[model samples]
Target: MLTSIKSFFSNELFNTEKGSTADSSEHQLQLACAALLIEVAVIDQEFDTRELQALITILQTKFNLSAEECETLRTLAQSESEDSTSMYQFTQLVNSACSPEQKFELIKGMWTIAYADGDLDKYEEYIVRKVSELIYVSHSEFIRAKLAARP
Candidate 1:
């Protein structure tokens, strides 16, 4: 288990040049982002239909994934997130591979998922805050993400 987890976080597997896509590194980064989003969706211990929809919508809008791709990514993310010990590894991958704009969009996606059920559970918000910090998102950017996602 740890080996697979370690491989997932291995720098060689995730060292994608920023702005490069359509490669293994991009795929790995996608998986990491998907996992973090799923973590937020389920943090409240009640994964509502609205939250699920929000997750799918966010992935589709942000990554332009087809339904089948979204399903596969979500399934992989769910399994990985269940086995993962911490968010740091995933955020580390994002920080290394993504541009600042990409990171901000992810934080905004997280906030959207957190608010999808119409109330932000304390734990959900905490996860978003922690992820923001881990991904090196500025406090101002974090606040902007939250405000941008506010409905």
Candidate 2:
């Protein structure tokens, strides 16, 4: 009963050069990013359709995932966000693997998911703030992302 990394990426399954089951760094990173957005959207105990669509939008544009691929990842990420206890695993991986600019972009995505319901839920705000800190996004940049993602 483990949440395998490959499951986070997709059920389609991919193999490495040696033919053993494996996920590339690129897929792993994108999964982490997607998982965080899922976490934020579900934080208020409501996985709104708007939030799901916002996540799909972010995943598609940010990771260049096809619409089909984005839906696959979104389904997998939702499972992870619900099954996992903390956001630390995803946030830690993202912080260590991505550049500052990338982290800022992630913050922006989180903000978008948070605001998808047309209002900033307090718990959603709290989750985004914690994620920004976990991913090393500066306070200034975090605030800027919040403002920019307001819709």
Candidate 3:
């Protein structure tokens, strides 16, 4: 699965810019974002269908991915999130690659997933809060994102 993910990132996603550092960075950024979303979705120990749909929508809209691409990303991100020791690995990449606005949007996406099932678990909120802090999103922005994403 890891090899396939690497192949997809290297070949399908950034084939146009192969061998470039920027391509590598972009691939990492995409994976990181997807992994973070997966993290939030699974934090409550139940990956709801609603959360899966919300995650797919976020990846498709935020990364401009097609359905197939989104599926591939979600699979890879699930694997990555499961094997990962902590959220910092994902959040660090986001902090370095994304702008403040992008980071805010990411927090909102996390919130969206948390609320997708019509219930927000405490662990889910904690994971989102931790990611927001790691990515340097202000406390006010975090609250704002939560409010904006509440459905």
Candidate 4:
């Protein structure tokens, strides 16, 4: 089943708008950003309450969203993160569209999420570092944010 999904995604026939079910750019961005956070939180497979709260906090502050809006995005992001076969689709979109500063902010946000529990797990560190590199965040800046975000 996974192979088939990958094949379908990789095929040229899947390139069109009709090829996949989800085509909403805005929705995809939200899902991608949120899911990436969730993914990092779950990289350790702990998915603790602190991480969840941190995710909600990040969403609320960054989007300037109300509680309802925060929950909506969180739910959508969680659903996608749980089911996603790959994180690249969303990361690629963010990389192409967001500014350098925004990318740096995202790295900061990822660090914030990782430190929500007051302890930085190995998996969380690995995930955020990898994601920071992918998003073009400098190593020093990434380290600084990670340290600052630490509880």
Best by TM-score: 3
Candidate 3: the clashing residue pairs are none
lDDT of each: 0.86, 0.81, 0.90, 0.74
Question: What TM-score, over all chains together, does every model reach?
Answer: 0.85, 0.87, 0.93, 0.78
Q: Report how far residue 17 has shifted in candidate 3, in Å.
A: 4.1
Q: Candidate 4 regions off by >4 Å?
A: 1-24
Report the C-alpha lDDT of model 2 over 13-72, residue by residue, as the tens digit: 433442233346667777778889888898899988898889998998997778987887
Residues 1-151 of candidate 1 have per-residue lDDT tens digits of 5346334434333444534545656677888999999999999899899999999999888878888778767877898899898987789899888999999999999999999999999999999999999998999999999999998
Runs off by more than 4 Å, candidate 3: 1-4
Pairing residues by index, what is the TM-score of model 4? 0.78
For model 3, state the Cα shift of residue 82 in Å: 0.6
Task: Report how far off residue 79 is in candidate 3 (Å).
Answer: 0.3
Tens-digit lDDT string for candidate 3 (1-151): 6567667788886565556678778878999999999998998889999999999999999989889989988988899999988888888899888999999999999999999999999999999999999999999999999999998
Better model by TM-score: candidate 3 vs candidate 4: 3
The better-scoring model by TM-score among 2 and 3 is: 3
Give the per-residue Cα lDDT of candidate 4 at 104: 74
Per-residue alpha-carbon lDDT of model 4 for 88-131, expressed as tens digits? 77689789767877777777889988888888889898989888
Give the runs in model 1 whose Cα sits over 4 Å from its true position.
Answer: 1-22
